[model samples]
Target: MDEKGGAIMLEELAFEIAKAAHAGQTDKAGLDYILHPLQVAAEMTTDEEKAVALLHDIIEDTDMTANELLAQGLPDNVVEAVEALTKKHNQNYAAYLAGVKKNRLATAVKLADLKHNSDLSRLEKITQKDRERAEKYRKAIEYLSK
Candidate 1:
């Protein structure tokens, strides 16, 4: 109806999409996968930022495309940020971070994503591989923090 109402609906839609897209998925810690995006979105300040955060992993992990999200009525900026946040299968981590840094919206959401991802406490058991991944996330956080 109004501007604020539209923003709320957008974020709600993002949440619904993310929930469905990640259904039956679990994180490395075996927690429900949707919690990651929910936590990331909670750290965002604006509705659009929250929406982007919620949908950030959709395209990367699911069959959904950016165009599909656009068709669902998400704003272009939100979709663009979500698209930027998606790292291609063949893309290097550093290169992906570089692209993420180029978009302010994606950067903010990514910082939150990295922050959540870096928390080893979320894992049931810490392993070499987990530590290594956290280290990589730490560096990405450092790079994105600048």
Candidate 2:
């Protein structure tokens, strides 16, 4: 395939991997798990950012690993941005948000993620854990805005 084709293929592959990884999963609102990544990707301004957004939860929520992402031919920067967006186990929300803020692309993706996760309409279905997460995201938004 040509260069352009390869790029397009990679993009498609990223979406496919994300969909497969999150299959059978659902959000707090009972929406398909894939919708979150799709929405995050839609909010991004660049292809690379969208790619990172699409795979943001793969490492944390699925069996997919960072090494697998690289082996699948994703660019180093995209992988790095995805990594930055992923929260490490036991890491504080503020610390994870700090990493996201440091990376421009990751910040963009994370802001979108927070926006979707914190939507007012979703409040009715949210649990205590969701409330805490939303609060953290709100704080992160403020921190990132500065």
RMSD (Å) per prediction: 2.4, 2.4
lDDT tens digits, residues 50-85, model 1? 999999999999999999999988999999999999
lDDT of 2 by residue, 20-46 (tens): 889999987788999989988888877
Candidate 1's error at 54, in angstroms?
0.6
- By summed lDDT, the worst window of 10 consecutive residues in model 1 runs over 1-10
State in Å the error of residue 65, model 2: 0.6
lDDT of 1 at 40: 96
- lDDT per model vs. reference: 0.92, 0.84
Report the Cα lDDT for residue 58, model 2: 93
